[model samples]
Target: MARVDLNDYVYVNARVRGMRSHLLTRDFFMRLVEADGFEALHALLEQTIYRREANEAFLLNPVRPDYDQALTLNLIAAFRKILDAVGGEPRRLVATLLSRYDVQNIKSVLRGKHGDATASEITNILVPVGSLRLEQLEVLAGQREIRDVINTMHAQQIKYARPLIDAYPDFTKKDHDLAVLELALDKYFYRDAIGQLKGKGTNTEMVRQMLVGEVDMRNISTLVRIRGVRLDDGEVENLRIPGGALSADEFLHLDRLGDIVRIVSDYPDPRYRKVLQKALAEYQEVDLVAFDRELEHEMTRRGAAMSNLDVLSIGVIIGFMWQKNNEVINLRILLRGKAMDRPQAQIRSDLFFVEREEGQAA
Candidate 1:
C-alpha cells in the first residue's frame, strides 16, 4: 500500500483551491469563438489556463502535433502536481485515473493499425498520461500483434491485461478487439482501484455512490446503443460491465427499456430520477450525446455539492478534479467548435453547466 499522511490535507486543499481559480468559465468560451485559427487559439490558451504548457509547447512548431503534444504534457504535469501535493497513497489513488490512458493508447494503436497509418502519425495522436510511460506505449504500438503488448503487460503484473488477452482470440480485426478491450479495461481498472480505497467516515460513500450511478448510466447508454445495432441479448450481456449500483436481477429485468425507467425511478435519490427523466426524454428524440452531457453535468454538480461540506475527505478532492477535468473538456469543445465554425447555440448545447441545486440534492 502507498503511504498516506492524512494531515497533509491542509496543504493539499490549499493548493487545489488556488489552482481551481484559474479554470475557464462560460465567458472564456464566448471569447474563444472570435479567434482566427490555431495560432490565435494558441495565443489565447497561453494567456489563460495553459500559460506554462503553451510556453513550453512553442519551443516546437505550432502545428497540430505540437499543440497536441503541449496539451498532453500540460495535462500530465498538472495531474502530477496534484499527486505530489497530496503525496503518499493519494498519489497512487489518483494515478489510477491516468491508467485510462492505457485504454486510450490501445484504441489509438488499433485505429492506426486498421487504417494502416504510419508509426509517426500514430505517435502524434497518442496522449501519454498513464502509469505506462510514452516509450512503453510506443513499444506497444510498434509490436507485430496484440499479444506483444499483452505479454509485456503480463511481465509487468498489470492486472487489467488479463481480460484483453482472454478476448484477443475472439478478435479477427482491429475495431472489434479495440472496442472489447477498451470496455473491459475500463471496468477492471476502475473496479480494482476504487475497491482498494478506504471510503469510510466521510462523504466517500456519497461520491462512491455517484461513481456507481455513472456506471448505471453508462450501462443504460450501452444497452440502448447495442439494441439499436440489433445485437442479441447474450452478446449484449457479454459486453456489459458489472459492479454498477444496478443489481443483476434489475438488469436482467431490463428486457424492455421501461424497466430502466422504473429502475431509475426507484433510486433512493429523487433528483437522479428527475434528471434522468428529463435527459431520457430528450434522448428519445435526439441523439444520446445531449443526455450523456446532462448526466456528466449532473454528476459534476453532485461532486461540487459534496465539496461544499466542511468535512475533510476525498469528496472535495474528487469534486475539484471533476471540475478541473470539466474545464479542460469544455475548452476543447469550444476550441473544436471555433475551428469548425460551429454556431454558438450548437456549442452551448454541448456545454453542461453545474447546477447548485443538483449538487445540493446529491
Candidate 2:
C-alpha cells in the first residue's frame, strides 16, 4: 500500500463533518429540557441522531438506564463506526485522541477496586473508545486487586500501567495516586506520541498549542482542586504533571501566590485565556464542578472552532472528536435532568455549549 498521506484526511474530515452535523444544537437542548422522564428522553433521542444506539440500548437495559451511560455507549459505538469507515492514518490519529479513555478506565479500575465497588459498577463507568479493549477493562475490573489490572496492561505496551504498579505500595492516598497516574499518562501520550511534532510546519503549531494549552488548564484545575481540599504544598506539587506550558515550579508558584487572576489576566493564548478566566471566576463563586465544566466547555469550543478552519492538518479531526465527546456529555445531562424531574430551565443551564459566548451561562 502507498504511504498514508494528508489526502486521506479529506475523507476522514468529510465523515467527521457529517457526524458533527448530528450533534444536538443549542436549540435541541432547549427542547430536551421539556422532556418529562427517561422514557420521554428516550423518545426524543430515538427521533434524533441517537436513534440507532437508543434502540439497541433500550432492548438491553429495557428500563431506561442512566441517560449518560446510554449516551456514552452510543457515542462510543458511533466513534468506532467512524473510525472503521476512515480506516488508515485517520484511524491512527483518532486512536491517539482516544488513548486517554484507557487511562481513565485504569483510574476507574483502581478507584473501584479501592472503594470495593462491584464489577458491574466499574464496567458501567468505563468508556471503551480507546486503544484498550472493553474486554480488557472488564477483565481488570474483575481482578481482586489493582496490581492485577496493571499487569494486564503490560501486554499492550501501555507503559502507564507501570506507574500504577509502582504507586500501589503507597496507595493509601487514593486520590493522590489517581491524579499522579492520570497526569503521568496525559504527559506520556503528548510528549511521546503527539509532542514529537514540535516543528513540522503546516498547522502543527496550532495543534500543539491546543494540546499544550489543554494540559496547562488541566494542571491549573488540579491545583485549584487540591488547594480546595486543603492539600499541603508537598502533596500538591507531587501531583503536578510537567508537560504543560507552565513548568512544575511555575504552576506551584502561581497556586501559592493566589495569582490565578493575574496569571490568566493577560494570558497570550486565547484558548487558555478564556478557560482561565472562567475557572478563576467559578472558583471564586461556586465549586470545582462548575469551574471544571466551564473550563471543559471552553476547550470544547476551541476545538470545535478549530475544526471549522480551512487548515488541512489534524485540527478538524481533533475538533470533531471533542465535539462528539461533548454530545455524549450533553445527552447524559439531559437524561439525568429528565430522570430527576428537574425543570427544563435548570437542565438547560447544565448543558455546555462549546460555541457559546463567554458571557452566556449555558
TM-score of each: 0.82, 0.84
Report every candidate's CA lDDT.
0.65, 0.70
Candidate 1 Cα misplacement greater than 4 A, ranges = 1-7, 36-42, 55-59, 62-66, 125-128, 173-177, 203-207, 228-233, 258-271, 355-362
The candidate that achieves the highest TM-score relative to the unseen native structure: 2
Alpha carbon RMSD to native, model 2: 4.3
Please provide, for model 1 over 287-352, each residue's C-alpha lDDT reduced to its tens digit, 9 standing for 90 to 100. 667767777777777666666775355555666777766766776677677667898788887776
Worst 10 residues of 2 by lDDT: 353-362
**Residue 28 of candidate 2: its Cα lDDT?**
76
- Which digits, one per residue and each the tens of the lDDT, describe model 2 over residues 128-170? 9887788878888998876666777776666677665666555
